[model samples]
Target: MKPGRNMRLAGLMRKEYLQVLRDPSSIAIAFVLPVVLLLIFGYGVSLDATNIRIALVIEQPDNIARNFAGSFDQSPYFAPRSFSSIQEAETALRRAEVDGIVWLRSDFGSGYLQNTSPPIGLIVNGVDANTARLVEGYVQGIWFTWLEQQMELAGKKMTSPVQLEQRIWYNPAVRSTDFLIPGILAVIMTLIGALLTALVIAREWERGTMEALLVTRISAPEILLGKLIPYFFLGMGGLGLSLVMAQFLFHVPMRGSLWLLLASSALFLWVALGMGFFISTVFRSQFVAALVAMVSTFLPAFILSGFIFDIRSMPVIIQGLTYLIAARYYVTILQTLFLVGDVWSVVWPNAATLALMGFFFHGVVYHKTKKNLQ
Candidate 1:
């Protein structure tokens, strides 16, 4: 093709753009999906909890109980309710009115003040394991911090018998959005790219227009590339907007290489497109393909990926299962890029993983399309 004919690429691109624009469902995924993902990930997925009500079923109105409850009241996250009897607190717990119930034994006052151990009870709602763990940590940490301060002033240096020193890498402060933003990039792009591709490709097949194009002797790869170029730009635009939102709106810093950030995101988008293409190839209905692609891509990215939650803390089987998620590696890239700049230790490995996943997914798309062609 000559220089003048190369300009035909622009017209081809424009045609592709117009076709996508004409499809209302395709347009919705491009424009509306990002906002939906941001909303869901922003408000829905959270670690910074506040005003978590705890019923203090104080068997004895001892100094320790009062002091603990008072300490809880001071914190932004805790709302303490002092109850005279355990029965009232139990009722509240059963009713889901309180997240946790703290019970003090009769000897709590004397035992806590003295060298003896104070037997305290902590009953938490086990419905949400993550929340339950956080509540438990807060209650325990607060009580111990208080005790340690008291002991220190009285010429006692009491080291915790069972000690745990947790240090979060990359994101030391552990901001929810800091952890979430990168995974959200993968999730949203996957949703938009895959869902949109499935619909657009399926629409062509459904309308019987693809059959006319098939006779041109053009390879499937060429057609796939043509289809992908348009969507890739759209996906990149969405990624850029999301990055801005993460930085300015959420206050998450971008501490790593901008090149690394772009490369990783680009690879993730490739995988997402492949996922969508695979679905569309197998299933003709845009709605069905979109639903399947979104569910498979989004949930794993959010849940299984080590973005907001730690995979190390989970069971061995669960930890093993995380490898199946491409977002797991992508989340590492995101954190490294945003918080730890030029740390090749983290950057290189994750970059390689993202590339591999992209290749694997694209290969699947290629094989599927080849089979369909035959």
Candidate 2:
């Protein structure tokens, strides 16, 4: 008599577990790869720009000029180097010794004495526009603060039409490491869930083991489940390792519910697994399957998932394309869970989308595999 469906599924899953143990590559991909990636992204990469080098030129070394230059020296954002003349400062800027130049004219003290706005000249290297803007803003902040101090010492209030108070939210310190480490989790899962499974299944096909399994009395759903169950646990193991490193090594805060993070991760992992199954089923060659998986899943997840780049800043066409990338949604969920607390508004929609994509891909793979059996 034919064995029961449950019996067949259990037997197939046991076989897959044995195969996973025998393969070292699978273990490395799931464990070692996350460590390497986390280290590279957490330590090697940074977006917070600090200690900008600036050359300061004072045409007349008066008390006001010296005091104004001292403001820049006190600021942690600037590393101020005094130059005797503008010509020397400009040359230093050209030679890349300094990122910016701050020039105080001879009229600086007189203008402040006459109760007028003293004009200051700022020259910044425009080669890196983002850094240049930051330097300019930091210089302006110093100037305004010095102006207020001068007014207070003179026993007068500085008259301005508007007073602005700024507050930074979410990541108040604005450390890029905090922003990047969470997003890297999405990339890790993509490799573990999509690339690993794709290569393993493709290897099975190349070795003729897949054909041997297909000739058995095992049904299509049973075969697919057998492949998925083992890898799902493997992917979760990788996820657990990544989380431990992210929390202890990198010190990224997890403000959301741990259960919620795990649930979303599971949903996205399901989608990634379905994607791998689809790719391997289409291309039985391991090389072709790996290449396709990297191109189709890894590259898109890295570039279009709003990990390093802002999605709103992309071209509208590209932004719309991001909606199709499962990593995009997963990255959003991760960032929210890590940086912000349990914000259901952000989490629910993204998780639901992942669920839909998972169902769609798994359903397609099921149909395709059933057709192969026929």
Candidate 3:
């Protein structure tokens, strides 16, 4: 009896595998989609601010003003276009030709030299608040450095009372690509794992195959296992491909144990797949299942998972809500493993959450399938 049941389960798995291969959409979702998304996230999205265009308006030309303006030209961060008057600079800014404008008034030389805080105007386009903030910070840094140099040239003792030495951990270079790629991996896995299985049971229902399968000798548990096994491998394959792209193409470091990363990824994939299966079981239409899977999985993974935005900076309620997002745990694990190595303090808790979620989602799927079968 046991051998017959095992054989039946194997046959069901084989049937699912064949069905996956025959479906062009499933093949595209399992394989092609990961690469396209990796390329898009790797190349198209960037957090590093560089080559910012700013108009420099000099009301009066002098040695002091020229020296100050020269510093902006030297910095790689800014592309300074000199304007004769504030009006010209304002025109450039209004036309969106520059991100910011630095204006040095006619009294800048005398007032600045006398420590009167010269009327230096920094007008920044605030369309993108984050970019505006970064530009403002960079400009202030340039101004301070120039001030320090001017003081030293005058033979005055220029020193800060307290010096700050900043050291960043995990990602020492502070490259956004290194930070982004790992989160992209989590998002990609979520899309592939959830979206694929989201269509499975729904497709079975649409084709009138669910009733036929129910009347067969195979039990609901065996059928679910059969569906789960094939797609589980498919999800893992997507993960492997995404990891290779992250390491080779994007040059993201993998400081953790490769085996451990794979293990945690497997746990996360289980949760994602189980969530997809639950959606599939609940919604009979393929279109509805796909939409719900995307809305529930992809959006939460991208937004609440701390992929691009810091959950800590969000409102208290939104921060509290992140605890419910499954991708939050997976993103933490991926970032830690890829950037910080296997810090089990971080990895253990997140992995445990993923395990619990997997069990919960799969248990719900099992209960629903049994009910539907009856």
Candidate 4:
């Protein structure tokens, strides 16, 4: 407001920047942490299951059975290991050597031309039900495809009640990393913005610098702004590093306008910073502030934000609780920006929510911050 307050704010920001430069941990948090996280999560984690080991048991080894078995070998999803008997395949399954077994009975070739359905058996290990379902689906896909091929070769049409055509949008390749990296970026921003500022006031108090600031003529609003401004840039710096890695290193497509992504990111970062500022002001101990920051911001961002798990798939109560997490909105914005582009329908609502949250948290911080240091 006044020129004197402006001068005080400017000086406070400058002091904060200098303090950050002097603190090696600040630099590490803002830059090194992003690099390390991106590298670890980008390369080390994946949801796709490939090269699944499966057992193939051909009862008669007929030309038809051999041709069908060849399809499993050609598929990228499966690595077929031939088993002479169903007993042997069962043993392999018990040993966890193969995920599934496909058995083509002796009557398979005859049944192909007959009125009866072919005698094909599929046995899948149910220890991991998800993987078992995937394996069973893969087996059915191969079966239907082979049946269609046989019908086509014999100049007979296969009858179907309905035909289905699938269209996969956003990520057609279905690489889980493409879906995961943007959400990880949102989590990273929460850590950078919240964790960095969470220690600011507490550290100042621990060092007796807060008393020195309290003695000054600077207002509470000015003090909070001064404390936030520098770390805001530092968090943005971390966001930039994460974006670069996502683009060049991970090759995650950025379909949205860069400006829109940055604008939404800025709003979200402000919300995250406000959360940290509130935590720092409430708890005067640096250790306590850091712990609270991680528990309140980081945990919510990681779990409730739908970073890895689908929020809708969560329990109804847990899904309702997610509305309180700022990162949930930011994660939606990040996924929309990175995968679906500048879809205002998605971005506008979430960005508005973030803006509202930012104002609310900062308002509380300003109200709670007193020059007397109570």
Candidate 5:
């Protein structure tokens, strides 16, 4: 730990950088991975549960039963299939073909609408808490809202008339796919790729491969970049998976330009990859690297990235910190791209922020890595 040891370490570190640059796997991951991740993230990771399968069982084909079933069909969330009896609907629900089942008894037409106990019952699978809540909320909002409006339309003079005209702005259809696809991209990509990089790199260090390369003739930046290349591609692969799921599987519309989406992703991944690499350099142990990456990237990307919650609603200091998080800008550009379309005015600012932040992290990583690797 004296001057001689420090100088000798610095000399060896320069050589390690060169060997890493020559590694092909690293280069492909760095250059091409970002675009793939944007695609996956844009399409794969969606919050909105679409076409949730529902079986509607009605004993009698009354106007009211038909009307009630009609309302559910009009909703994007429910793909309502009619059945003659409750047993049929229950079978579908149990067999996992349907997420929920609605049963309408023979007397649903007259008795149910007259403030009597509902002849219709909604039975849902409670295994996935999030999907279950979404199904329940959709049924409540869509079916009950229609019922409330019907009562008012009948000209009944009732006290405390509730006039709930709920309008969803930005995403007019209230589609979860629009919001969730972009948000989950920030989360899943980070988890599957960015978070993985630090551990993988730290493992190399712990196992002495990094030291073997250190005796060669590469520069510090080359070594850092080399480490980043493979992980960067891995992250993009995750992104590609998500995009296929979002656009093809879920059928969410692509309103924005794909070019813009790729552009934003490039900048965001740069920052994320840099952050992960820097973490690996700092924490040589795989365990600590994993923990730091999870705490630093995964949790924030999921929660504070505006994936699950609104950043504006958070405390002022927290909101300020979100600016430093790569996921924040990624969320912004991706959301605007997905929901608002190719809005350059809306997208550019976030893109610029990501570029700037990426550079900042790049500088931090270069400095830390050069010292640590040396």
Candidate 6:
């Protein structure tokens, strides 16, 4: 009986493998999709604010205005384009030629030396709120530094009681790519695991193969296991390729054990695959399954998984909804392992959650498959 079961399982797995090989779309999802996503997310997307373009308008051309404009020019953060009139600067701003406008009023030459707030106007394009905020902070920093320099040149003492020293942990240089690539890996895995498996059972039903398989001696467990084993390896292959691209192509570091990373990734992939299988089992239409998988997996993974946005800053209801996303836990695991190493305090709970989710999804798939078989 054991030998017969093993032979049947092997035959089923072989059939699944042949099917995967025949389908170009499946191969693309398993292999080409990861590389494409890595390139798009790694190179095309960025959070670091630098080289902000600003139009500098000096209403009255004077030493004070020139000096302030000089200060902005000297700073690496600002690429200043000087304008003779506020109207001209506004034109540039309207055209999106500059990210912000710095206007020095006509009274700036006299008022600036009086130790009062200078008649300087800052107009920022607030279309991208984050970039505008960054530009505002940088402009303020520049203004303060220029004020200190002017005080020193005039032989006046400038002192502040408190000095702020910032230390960033995990990522010292704070490169966004380092923080992003790991999360990208999670997203890539979610796509491969969920999207591909979503098409599996649906394709079988559409092609009239599920009924034929049911007429055979194959048990529900054997059918499900056959579907999973091949795709599990495919998912792992995609994971491995993504890791290599992250390290070699994008220069992302991995501080944790490779084995531990693989283990956690396997757990996450299991849950993702189970989700796909469950979706496929419930909705036998390939189109419906694919659409549902993308909506339920990809969109949530990108948004609610803390990949680009902070969960703490979101609305309370949205924050609570994130708990249901499997990618959230996997993303946390990936970021910790890649940036902070194997911190069991972080890894254990997330891994357990993924394992539990995997079990729950696969159990549903099993029950559904059994019902369909009967």
Q: What is the TM-score of each candidate against the true structure?
A: 0.84, 0.92, 0.94, 0.93, 0.61, 0.93
Off by over 4 Å in 5: 1-170, 371-374
User: Candidate 3: what lDDT?
Assistant: 0.91
Candidate 2 segments whose C-alpha is farther than 4 A from its true place: 1-3, 152-156, 371-374
Q: Cα lDDT of model 5 overall?
A: 0.73
Q: After superposition, how far is residue 371 of candidate 6 from its true place, in Å?
A: 7.5
Ranking, TM-score, top scorer first? 3, 4, 6, 2, 1, 5
Sort by lDDT, best first.
2, 6, 3, 4, 1, 5
lDDT (C-alpha) at residue 253 in model 6: 84
Number of clashes recorded per candidate: 1, 0, 0, 0, 23, 0
* Candidate 3: residue 177 Cα off by (Å): 1.0
Clashes of 2: 0
lDDT of 4 by residue, 188-297 (tens): 88988898888877898899999998988988888888988898899999999899999999999999999999988889999999998889888889999999999999
lDDT tens digits, residues 97-189, model 5?
A: 999988877888878667686656889999898899988888888876677667788876444567656777678877666677677767666
Which 10 residues in a row give candidate 1 its minimum summed lDDT? 2-11
Q: Give per-residue CA lDDT, model 3, range 117-204, as digits (tens).
A: 8878999999999999999999999998898888888988667798767889989988899999999888888987888888877899
Residue-wise lDDT of candidate 6 within 22-43, one digit each (tens)? 9999999989999999998899
lDDT of 3 at 186: 88
On lDDT, who's better, 1 or 2? Answer: 2
Residue 23, model 3, lDDT:
94
Candidate 1 global CA lDDT score: 0.78
